[model samples]
Target: MIFPTPEEYTVLVLSLKVGLLCVVISLPFAVLLGWVLARKNFRGKLILDGLCHLPLVLPPVVVGYLLLLLLGRRGFLGQILNDWFGLQIAFTWRGAVLAAAVVGFPLMLRAVRLAIESVDPRLERAARTLGANPLRAFFSITLRLAAPGVLVGSLLAFARSLGEFGATITFVSNIAGETRTLPLAIFTYINQPDGEAAAARLVLLSIILSLGALIASEAIARKMKT
Candidate 1:
């Protein structure tokens, strides 16, 4: 109602956009990584798993800096992207999505991996014996069985992305319309002398969002069980 101002609304929408984009961009990769970790045995698997989780252990600021180095215009990959594709990530909404994906991916991957591992390999084998291909068997048996975990993982990732601040701010800066998100906006409001009310509103919105996600995840899990 009389809560967030227009600027705050813009930040909220931007945060949701970044969060959704992060989820969409990372879901396929997260599912693949999850399946790999859950089912595959390969050399350096531990290293790969650790690398996927490095963002979780490292400081958000450090993660942000790393993204900046890798995706900044002057960085190697960034330079190539700019020169070859005319794409830019630094200081843009896309950069915010990238930061959110980097941080949220581990949670999604872990959940999906656990879910995939929980599925019965025998069922997949049975599907294969019934003339199904590997991909078909996986989708019909393994992925169907793991739907609950996938939903949980996605919700967790969404929640994490919604709250992302340090990495996003570092990689994308705090541009008002382009990159500012709810957490960044809250931080900005807190910095101003008369911004306590707005900051409080944003904090409340964050809590509501987190709670809603949890509730929705539980509902999805229940629906999948049925």
Candidate 2:
């Protein structure tokens, strides 16, 4: 019956917030990219797919550094965003969300693409022939059939975001009560002489959260088949 200390609780909440936000922000884009990769055969399509999945193959630190270069305060896009909208992402929770989203996006995209590909294209064509526009046919037929995969992908991305470490730390560093998520908190604890107990607790919590997401994803996939 051990309760989480305030610090642990904060870390937990922040981690959940980041993970959920990452999923919500990235899901729509993943769905669009997945649909395109599965259904379209245009020039440079393979290149686009490879770029989308590059994060999966690259080192997390490299990904983070790239993000920093592209979004740092003085960076081209970062400067524009800061000047135009007064928005900042680096060294903040928002940065954490972005990092997690980028890293987990590949998994989300792959799951959705596979799911959509499995659906019969003819169903969408049939809908189109029935006077529905392409967008309507996709939403009503293709996307509906692929919903389970989308759900599963969301869960998988959530799980990945929860465990995100290298990229987050590299991009945002560790700021207590700010950008310090569960992984960062655990890392901090492990480095301290009296932090083992806290680290262990956080580790267990991380396991629980990640395991739950994975289990839920598997359950959804099974349900989709049946």
Candidate 3:
């Protein structure tokens, strides 16, 4: 294995863990936000839309720094979380997850929103006419129709999280077995004089993983269509 060293393995595992955690944390919120943005017209909708897309527009380092400020021990929400629940998001694995989620969330949300918007509102109305409640109609009609988009969004988010570097490194640092992920590992390898081989291995791994995810997403989308 290219990652013959225990440190490399630790970094690999931590990276995967952070990526998975980011996906799980962002999935539900992405769906809800996507549905709302696609279907509902509310006051301040544009503001909410802009906020959701802010991370995409901002630099990753800036986002990480903002996260550090907002979730630091002395920060407002951070202090409440620490005092009430003893949760710390600074320089930790959880912090890495937060960083990844913040960056990946916009992609997921955008995908899901497009999917929801493509769904015909008439279908929802028909379900409601059959005595289904709004929530029930959404699950039965809107969700089913938007499954492909959701899958695509999830895959995109997962891939994005897996490759996250700047925000993760800035927010959590490149601590082995904690915040070190694939991109961070690659960067570490590249920093060394004789680290080319290791970096190449990780780079190839990232490409392969991304390709596999794209293939899998297409397969799932096709199956849903059939």
Report the C-alpha lDDT of model 1 over 146-202, residue by residue, as the tens digit: 999998999999999999988998899999999998889889989999999888998
Ordered from best to worst lDDT, the candidate numbers read: 2, 1, 3
Query: Model 2, clash count?
Result: 0
Per-candidate clashes come to 0, 0, 0
lDDT for model 1 comes to 0.92
Q: For model 2, how does the per-residue alpha-carbon lDDT over 1-226 read when each residue is reduced to its tens digit? A: 3889898999999999999999999989998999999999999998999999999999999999988999999888889989999999889999999999999999999999998999999999999889999999999999999999999989989999999999999999899988999999999999999999889999999999999888988887788867
Which residue ranges in model 2 land beyond 4 Å of their true spot? none
What is the per-residue lDDT of model 3 for residues 117-157, given as tens digits with 9 covering 90 to 100? 99999999999999999999999999989999999999888
User: Which 10-residue window in model 1 sums to the lowest lDDT?
Assistant: 1-10
- Show the colliding residue pairs in model 3: none
> Lowest-scoring 10 consecutive residues by lDDT in candidate 3?
1-10
Task: Kindly indicate the candidate among 1 and 3 with the higher TM-score.
Answer: 1
Overall local distance difference test of candidate 3? 0.89
